[model samples]
Target chain A: DAGITQSPRHKVTETGTPVTLRCHQTENHRYMYWYRQDPGHGLRLIHYSYGVKDTDKGEVSDGYSVSRSKTEDFLLTLESATSSQTSVYFCAIRGDSFQETQYFGPGTRLLVL
Target chain B: AQTVTQSQPEMSVQEAETVTLSCTYDTSENNYYLFWYKQPPSRQMILVIRQEAYKQQNATENRFSVNFQKAAKSFSLKISDSQLGDTAMYFCAFGQVAGGGAQKLVFGQGTRLTINP
Candidate 1:
């Protein structure tokens, strides 16, 4: 898990409501990413942030948004959650040194009813 | 765009045996990275090994090694002297440096590996 921790590890929410997942890191890595894992799909990127206040979309960014206000916190929000959006979300961070590789958090399991 | 494929969905082997998991990727970019991730029942994504495209030498991590064929665009993981703790779902991933130098990863469907006693 490195220094990463995801809040609300398990969440049960209703469709059409809003949901936000938090990823906090203590090492202050320069890069952070959000991904979702599902059966037969392994894991797909949802969004990533290169630095504080700098963010971009990923392969499966639809229906989801991200915010990186501080270097330590990255948030992923489902403005209008749908049943199809139910999956386990993971957060990862890249070390500042030579393509060191990304370390992941424990992950958050979100179920939309 | 890059895509990673792990052809084997599941594999079973006895402890101390050797096994290989196949992974093929499609990508036009020459500068990239290849990785193998292991996820056990605990669901923790652990980094197994990685290979850089620019490097000609294959990557090895103790009991784990990779057979990377750059021309064929294939990267396979081989495990020797397997142990029961090695049983897990293994994912192959392709990585590229995105805008602002962020490395983005695309993963395969995953291969469930079981090491029997």
Candidate 2:
């Protein structure tokens, strides 16, 4: 509903392989975030960008990297996939307003063998 | 660090009944915000309700409302006239009021709700 889309809705790959997940937003919000959801752990932020080329690490930023070259595109990359990295990834965007509600994407389910 | 805790992992409510989901958070900041998000079997996350810490009155949206106790540091969601479609996983989140007016949310593990026919 927020015009947010996450590409590669489902991905299965082997360990040590490289993988990338993309999140595209048509709203052109000022903030974008990447999160991983796992059973019992809920959703944890991995990386976030406030503007193009302005990014920051989150609570669980290890082994993952992100890039936001433009306002509409945010990408998450796994340099070398690991089994522990398997989870459902979600992308969210929020306006520049204070505590504005965030809009989420459908999510991408990734599995590492 | 701020933390949100959802005590109930699984809960069930009969159709047309009312149910309350409990959420407690730990934060030292006086100015902040709380939110409730719902994720159904479709796995699409949806916002249910929100409450500002500075507000004394709770927030309500249709059949959904929040009992925000700032002193108690608790924010709970109550759903009235629950329906089968209400079944989903609910998450409670906290966000600090940033100086620049940008809010970044910290979320809880979540509670799975099942509405029985």
Candidate 3:
């Protein structure tokens, strides 16, 4: 285990509301990623952070944002929640180079009504 | 853009039997990595096996192994002596290293594997 945890394991929010999910890791990994899992789409990357204050957009970055102010914490925010954003969000950390395994935390299940 | 495809949406195998899951990926980059991740009912993604494109020999982990056919763009996972614990949603992923050592993964839709005991 890489000591990873995602807060608010399950959440329910109404449409147009603001919601933020948090991912905390104790491994001090330099790379952290956020992905959303849907029935037919599998897991699509939402956003990722390489280091403190450095982040980049992923394949499905629309309607989502991410910030990493510290090495241990990475946050994903949905500025205005929508029904399409309802899915399981997973957070993963890569401590080393490309060959290393990316450790994933228990996913956060979010439902937008 | 890189794409990973898993044609089989569901598969079943008897306990102690061997089963293989298929995965194919399309990528122009020569240097990359392929992986198989298992997501059990707990919803935690566990790495089953990984293969580096540069390696000619297949990679194996315990009862799990991968058949990497680079020319055919196919990566398949073989599980020997399957157990009930192996029942889970298996996902195939492709990772490409970008600038600054940031590697991003593209995953397949997943295959639901059931091990009947």
TM-score on alpha carbons, each prediction: 0.99, 0.97, 0.99
lDDT of 3 by residue, A22-51 (tens): 999999899999999999878998888888
- Native-referenced DockQ of model 1: 0.79
Question: What TM-score does prediction 2 earn?
Answer: 0.97
Of 2 and 3, the candidate ranking higher by lDDT: 3
What DockQ does candidate 3 have relative to the true complex? 0.79
Q: What would the per-residue lDDT of candidate 2 be over residues A69-95, giving only the tens digit for each residue?
A: 999999999999999999999999999
Q: Show pairs that collide, candidate 2.
A: none
Evaluated on chain B only, what is the TM-score of candidate 1?
0.99
Local accuracy of candidate 3 as per-residue lDDT tens digits, B74-117: 99999999999999999999998864588899999999999998
Pick the lDDT winner.
1
Q: For residues B1-117, could you state the per-residue lDDT of candidate 1 as single tens digits?
A: 788999999999999999999999999999999999999999989999999999999999999999999999999999999999999999999998897889999999999999999
Candidate 1: the clashing residue pairs are none
The candidate with the higher TM-score, 1 or 2, is 1
Question: Model 3, retained fraction of real contacts?
Answer: 0.72
